[model samples]
Target: MAAKTYSAQHFVECDQCEENPAQYFCKNCPGQLCKECKTEHKNRKITKNHEITELNTKNEAFFGPLFCTDHKTKQIQCFCVHCKIPLCTECIIESHNGHAIQKLTKAYKEIQDDLQKKKEKIEEDLLPKYAMLLKTENLKQSDFSKQAQEIEKEIKAHTRQLVRIVKQVGKNATEDFQAKLHKGLQRIVDSEVEIQRKIEKLKQTKDLLSAKIETKPTVSSFEPVNERLLDEFEKLPVLPKYHFSKFQPGKIESMIEKNFGKLPILKIDTAKPNEGDSDIDSQEEEVEEEESDSEVPYNLRLVQESRRF
Candidate 1:
């Protein structure tokens, strides 16, 4: 729309007509590369490397210049489909000379057609597979949620039961120890009372014996005490730790095949239509014709691979 303006000292670059034209003509991809720049653009090592589109033309630039690797000066205008490289007419007499050389324009169109077929195939075949994958994942997630919830509930209930058992075991052990403590305390109390009575009798008898005269020795003492009895209560067994299974990552065996095996195709029978449905019949015929014409027969890719003889 708006023309490029330049200062009086310097001239504006023209993209279409000429260097410093009266009016700016058209634009290319990036910052306006002028028409004068086209020669420089084509000659540069990096710019020559790029698929540079001309600003003035509708033709999209693909695969730069298509120059013959053998013939440096020549633009490769013909593609030897057998050799699959661009070749000038002069190269025809060389080793691969006799092979088929289709014009580059036809080759380009043929490639475009092949790519279109591939794109459509991806939509027809792989797209449905992708959608099916999504559907399967969603369904599986729902099922897993339901089942995992049930499993978690079961695990929680079992865990609570185990905890109750552990608590009961602990309570029983504590109560048993307390009962043993009661017996030990009673035994110690009875022993202390017996000793006290013996001491009091000895004190009275000793006072009398001292009043009479002094005698030789005395009786021995007992060994087992309340501390020894409590040691028996201290030797109770300990409770064990709780364990659980972890959730692993991967598709379950049964679920794997259902998601991955195949893309489904629907069966349909074409019925002959009467005069009233002739329009539908014509459309179907046209579609079939287009489909047949548009199919990609075969071609090698840009990448190379080993071929079978």
Candidate 2:
């Protein structure tokens, strides 16, 4: 082989002699080696398989570290799996003795493959799937809010209708009660007027009897007035008793409450897609129809009591 050339500025001294300019760089010894030193390095049993690159083939600045830190004259050729560190031949025999070790190239290839697999999984599967899941959850949240609002509106409308009905019922019941009360009161007033007339007649007859006695009028006239007074007194009218019927408002409230209780469990039929239909548009249409079909009817009856005053 032709003698290797060395650049003046890029020249490295041989690690063994520290005299001649280095011609070969040993990746295992990780040090510069002159021609003489290279011969000696190859002869050594531990460094026989060490990779050596010609320094003259490329720029010296691009070359990586050729010598081990702990073993100054040795190169990092092996990796210690246990400690996860690079080692020279001497390091392997000394500190990393009996540990699981492999060539740096072999460890590099294996670790590179593992990292590539992880990157592919993240880019192709994990990240996309997670993003889709996030989108679905957001849509579900929006749907939930929308459905809740719609149900609330329906509830308010139903409640207003119920309130109107209750109010009308109450007004009608009040008017009916008032009419009955008025009729009862008028009958009582008429009885009172008749009693008053009889009292006045009795008073007049008594006064005539007194006048006859004082004047010493004829006995026949006084006797007749006394008899008429006794008859009017005996025939006095008795007053009739009256009372208002009890109106229970709580029964109406209870009926409303019972109907309202069913609101939570009221079944709204949802449209289901046929098993044979696989079209996405069909599925969406079915969902929309089901949503539109969902209806909760307020089934309530007015509670009223019947009583006579």
Candidate with top TM-score is 2
> For residue 155, what is the lDDT in candidate 1?
32
Clashes (backbone N, CA, C under 3 Å), per candidate, total 1, 5
TM-score of each: 0.34, 0.36
Q: On a 0 to 100 scale, what is the lDDT of residue 287 in model 1?
A: 11
How well is each residue in 156-234 modelled by candidate 1, as lDDT tens digits? 4432432333333333333433343344334334534543454354345334333222111110001111223223222
Off by over 4 Å in 2: 1-63, 66-74, 81-84, 98-100, 164-254, 263-309
lDDT of 2 by residue, 1-309 (tens): 354555433345678777777778787657778888899899999998988777642233213454566888886766778876667889888889999997665554454444444445445644454344344335534553454445445444444555655544444434434454445446545645564554455445434433432221111211212223243344323322333322223333566533432222211222222222333322221111123243432232322321111
- Whole-model Cα lDDT of every candidate shown, in order: 0.37, 0.48
Q: Lowest-scoring 10 consecutive residues by lDDT in candidate 2?
A: 216-225
Q: What is the lDDT of residue 272 in candidate 2?
A: 26
